[model samples]
Target: MPKIIYVDPDGTRHVVDAPDGTSLMQAAVANGVEGVLGECGGSAMCATCHVYVDPADGGRLPELGADEDEMLDSTASPRTTASRLSCQLTASEDLDGLVVRLPEEQI
Candidate 1:
Protein backbone atom coordinates (compact mmCIF):
# COMPACT_ATOMS: atom_id res chain seq x y z
CA MET A 1 0.00 0.00 0.00
CA PRO A 2 1.14 3.52 -0.69
CA LYS A 3 1.02 6.24 1.94
CA ILE A 4 -0.86 9.51 1.56
CA ILE A 5 -0.09 12.58 3.64
CA TYR A 6 -3.08 14.91 3.66
CA VAL A 7 -2.66 18.42 4.94
CA ASP A 8 -5.60 20.51 6.05
CA PRO A 9 -6.04 24.27 5.76
CA ASP A 10 -4.96 24.62 9.40
CA GLY A 11 -1.73 22.82 8.51
CA THR A 12 -2.71 19.66 10.34
CA ARG A 13 -1.47 16.47 8.70
CA HIS A 14 -2.99 13.02 8.49
CA VAL A 15 -1.01 10.14 7.10
CA VAL A 16 -3.02 7.22 5.78
CA ASP A 17 -2.04 4.02 4.05
CA ALA A 18 -3.64 3.88 0.63
CA PRO A 19 -4.33 0.54 -0.99
CA ASP A 20 -3.18 0.18 -4.56
CA GLY A 21 -5.60 0.79 -7.45
CA THR A 22 -7.96 2.78 -5.23
CA SER A 23 -8.43 6.51 -5.72
CA LEU A 24 -6.93 8.95 -3.22
CA MET A 25 -10.45 10.13 -2.44
CA GLN A 26 -11.34 6.61 -1.39
CA ALA A 27 -8.34 6.39 0.88
CA ALA A 28 -9.16 9.69 2.51
CA VAL A 29 -12.81 8.81 2.95
CA ALA A 30 -12.05 5.38 4.39
CA ASN A 31 -9.59 6.84 6.84
CA GLY A 32 -12.00 9.63 7.80
CA VAL A 33 -9.45 12.30 7.06
CA GLU A 34 -11.26 15.52 8.04
CA GLY A 35 -10.45 17.66 5.01
CA VAL A 36 -11.43 15.38 2.17
CA LEU A 37 -15.15 15.24 1.59
CA GLY A 38 -15.19 12.83 -1.39
CA GLU A 39 -18.86 13.59 -1.79
CA CYS A 40 -19.21 12.04 -5.21
CA GLY A 41 -17.67 8.74 -4.23
CA GLY A 42 -14.65 9.14 -6.49
CA SER A 43 -16.69 10.13 -9.47
CA ALA A 44 -15.43 13.13 -11.40
CA MET A 45 -18.82 14.77 -10.99
CA CYS A 46 -18.03 16.67 -7.81
CA ALA A 47 -15.22 18.99 -6.89
CA THR A 48 -15.45 18.21 -3.19
CA CYS A 49 -12.24 16.24 -3.38
CA HIS A 50 -10.20 19.18 -4.61
CA VAL A 51 -6.59 19.18 -3.53
CA TYR A 52 -3.34 20.92 -4.26
CA VAL A 53 -0.51 18.61 -5.23
CA ASP A 54 2.65 19.78 -3.52
CA PRO A 55 4.85 21.38 -6.18
CA ALA A 56 7.79 19.18 -5.28
CA ASP A 57 5.83 16.05 -6.15
CA GLY A 58 3.49 17.48 -8.79
CA GLY A 59 5.47 16.15 -11.69
CA ARG A 60 5.23 12.65 -10.33
CA LEU A 61 1.46 12.60 -10.61
CA PRO A 62 -0.42 11.65 -13.72
CA GLU A 63 -1.87 14.43 -15.81
CA LEU A 64 -5.46 15.39 -15.17
CA GLY A 65 -8.13 14.16 -17.54
CA ALA A 66 -10.83 16.32 -19.14
CA ASP A 67 -13.51 15.47 -16.61
CA GLU A 68 -11.27 16.29 -13.70
CA ASP A 69 -10.18 19.46 -15.41
CA GLU A 70 -13.75 20.56 -15.94
CA MET A 71 -14.84 19.72 -12.43
CA LEU A 72 -11.99 21.67 -10.92
CA ASP A 73 -13.23 24.75 -12.74
CA SER A 74 -16.37 24.51 -10.67
CA THR A 75 -14.65 24.92 -7.33
CA ALA A 76 -15.45 28.09 -5.40
CA SER A 77 -11.83 28.35 -4.31
CA PRO A 78 -9.13 29.76 -6.50
CA ARG A 79 -7.47 27.08 -8.57
CA THR A 80 -3.76 26.82 -8.92
CA THR A 81 -1.53 25.08 -11.46
CA ALA A 82 -1.23 22.28 -8.91
CA SER A 83 -4.97 21.84 -8.44
CA ARG A 84 -6.32 18.30 -8.67
CA LEU A 85 -9.38 16.29 -7.85
CA SER A 86 -8.53 13.42 -5.52
CA CYS A 87 -11.05 11.17 -7.26
CA GLN A 88 -8.78 11.28 -10.28
CA LEU A 89 -5.68 10.26 -8.33
CA THR A 90 -5.13 6.54 -8.15
CA ALA A 91 -2.95 5.18 -5.38
CA SER A 92 0.21 3.46 -6.60
CA GLU A 93 3.71 2.57 -5.51
CA ASP A 94 5.04 5.60 -7.39
CA LEU A 95 2.84 7.71 -5.15
CA ASP A 96 3.93 6.00 -1.95
CA GLY A 97 4.70 9.21 -0.16
CA LEU A 98 2.44 11.58 -2.05
CA VAL A 99 1.18 14.58 -0.17
CA VAL A 100 -1.88 16.73 -0.95
CA ARG A 101 -3.20 19.86 0.66
CA LEU A 102 -6.94 20.34 1.05
CA PRO A 103 -8.70 23.55 0.17
CA GLU A 104 -10.18 25.65 2.99
CA GLU A 105 -13.64 24.86 1.71
CA GLN A 106 -15.08 22.26 -0.69
CA ILE A 107 -18.54 23.13 -1.92
Candidate 2:
Protein backbone atom coordinates (compact mmCIF):
# COMPACT_ATOMS: atom_id res chain seq x y z
CA MET A 1 0.00 0.00 0.00
CA PRO A 2 1.05 3.54 -0.66
CA LYS A 3 0.80 6.11 2.12
CA ILE A 4 -0.90 9.27 0.98
CA ILE A 5 -0.88 12.42 3.08
CA TYR A 6 -3.74 14.83 2.47
CA VAL A 7 -3.42 18.28 3.95
CA ASP A 8 -6.61 20.28 4.26
CA PRO A 9 -6.84 23.99 3.58
CA ASP A 10 -6.63 24.71 7.28
CA GLY A 11 -3.53 22.51 7.62
CA THR A 12 -5.13 19.39 9.02
CA ARG A 13 -3.39 16.27 7.76
CA HIS A 14 -5.09 12.97 6.99
CA VAL A 15 -2.83 10.02 6.38
CA VAL A 16 -4.22 7.03 4.56
CA ASP A 17 -2.99 3.74 3.22
CA ALA A 18 -4.12 3.36 -0.36
CA PRO A 19 -4.15 -0.01 -2.01
CA ASP A 20 -2.30 -0.36 -5.28
CA GLY A 21 -4.29 0.83 -8.29
CA THR A 22 -6.73 2.84 -6.16
CA SER A 23 -7.20 6.47 -7.05
CA LEU A 24 -6.07 9.06 -4.55
CA MET A 25 -9.57 10.51 -4.48
CA GLN A 26 -11.00 7.10 -3.64
CA ALA A 27 -8.56 6.65 -0.82
CA ALA A 28 -9.33 10.06 0.64
CA VAL A 29 -13.09 9.68 0.36
CA ALA A 30 -12.98 6.21 1.84
CA ASN A 31 -10.81 7.31 4.76
CA GLY A 32 -13.02 10.31 5.57
CA VAL A 33 -10.43 12.87 4.66
CA GLU A 34 -11.92 16.35 4.55
CA GLY A 35 -11.60 18.53 1.41
CA VAL A 36 -11.73 15.77 -1.18
CA LEU A 37 -15.34 15.35 -2.27
CA GLY A 38 -14.76 12.98 -5.21
CA GLU A 39 -18.18 14.00 -6.42
CA CYS A 40 -17.71 12.28 -9.74
CA GLY A 41 -16.63 9.01 -8.18
CA GLY A 42 -13.09 8.83 -9.53
CA SER A 43 -14.05 10.15 -12.92
CA ALA A 44 -11.93 12.92 -14.42
CA MET A 45 -15.04 14.78 -15.60
CA CYS A 46 -15.30 16.64 -12.29
CA ALA A 47 -12.69 18.78 -10.63
CA THR A 48 -14.05 18.23 -7.12
CA CYS A 49 -11.09 16.01 -6.36
CA HIS A 50 -8.53 18.68 -7.13
CA VAL A 51 -5.36 18.75 -5.07
CA TYR A 52 -1.92 20.31 -5.17
CA VAL A 53 0.88 17.82 -5.33
CA ASP A 54 3.77 18.60 -3.05
CA PRO A 55 6.38 20.15 -5.34
CA ALA A 56 9.01 17.84 -3.97
CA ASP A 57 6.99 14.81 -4.97
CA GLY A 58 5.69 16.21 -8.23
CA GLY A 59 8.15 14.23 -10.29
CA ARG A 60 6.80 10.97 -8.91
CA LEU A 61 3.22 11.50 -10.13
CA PRO A 62 1.97 10.35 -13.48
CA GLU A 63 1.67 12.81 -16.33
CA LEU A 64 -1.49 14.94 -16.54
CA GLY A 65 -4.04 13.58 -18.97
CA ALA A 66 -6.31 15.42 -21.39
CA ASP A 67 -9.53 14.92 -19.41
CA GLU A 68 -8.00 16.07 -16.16
CA ASP A 69 -6.36 19.01 -17.87
CA GLU A 70 -9.67 20.18 -19.26
CA MET A 71 -11.55 19.85 -15.96
CA LEU A 72 -8.89 21.64 -13.98
CA ASP A 73 -9.88 24.88 -15.68
CA SER A 74 -13.28 24.54 -14.08
CA THR A 75 -12.10 24.14 -10.52
CA ALA A 76 -13.51 26.54 -7.92
CA SER A 77 -10.04 27.23 -6.66
CA PRO A 78 -7.25 28.76 -8.70
CA ARG A 79 -5.08 26.24 -10.47
CA THR A 80 -1.32 26.01 -10.26
CA THR A 81 1.36 23.98 -11.99
CA ALA A 82 1.03 21.48 -9.17
CA SER A 83 -2.73 21.22 -9.51
CA ARG A 84 -4.00 17.71 -10.28
CA LEU A 85 -7.22 15.76 -10.07
CA SER A 86 -6.76 13.14 -7.40
CA CYS A 87 -8.98 10.74 -9.32
CA GLN A 88 -6.35 10.56 -12.02
CA LEU A 89 -3.58 9.68 -9.60
CA THR A 90 -3.28 5.96 -8.98
CA ALA A 91 -1.59 4.46 -5.95
CA SER A 92 1.68 2.58 -6.45
CA GLU A 93 4.96 2.00 -4.71
CA ASP A 94 6.45 4.93 -6.59
CA LEU A 95 3.87 7.15 -4.95
CA ASP A 96 4.47 6.06 -1.41
CA GLY A 97 4.53 9.01 0.99
CA LEU A 98 2.91 11.25 -1.57
CA VAL A 99 1.65 14.49 -0.05
CA VAL A 100 -1.06 16.69 -1.50
CA ARG A 101 -2.61 19.94 -0.35
CA LEU A 102 -6.33 20.52 -0.66
CA PRO A 103 -7.68 23.73 -2.04
CA GLU A 104 -9.86 26.12 -0.03
CA GLU A 105 -12.93 24.83 -1.80
CA GLN A 106 -13.90 21.92 -4.09
CA ILE A 107 -17.25 23.10 -5.40
Root-mean-square deviation of every model: 0.9, 0.8
Summed over model 1, clashes come to 0
lDDT of each: 0.89, 0.92
Which segments of candidate 1 are over 4 A away from where they belong?
none
Q: For residue 19, what is the lDDT in candidate 1?
A: 96
lDDT of 1 by residue, 1-107 (tens): 89999999989999999999999999999999867888878889989889999888987888889899999899867799989999899999999989899998887
lDDT of 1 at 78: 79
lDDT for each residue of candidate 2 in 1-107, tens digit (9 for 90 to 100): 78999998888999999999999999999999979999889878889999999777888988888889999999999999989999999999999998899999999
TM-score of each: 0.95, 0.96
TM-score of 2: 0.96
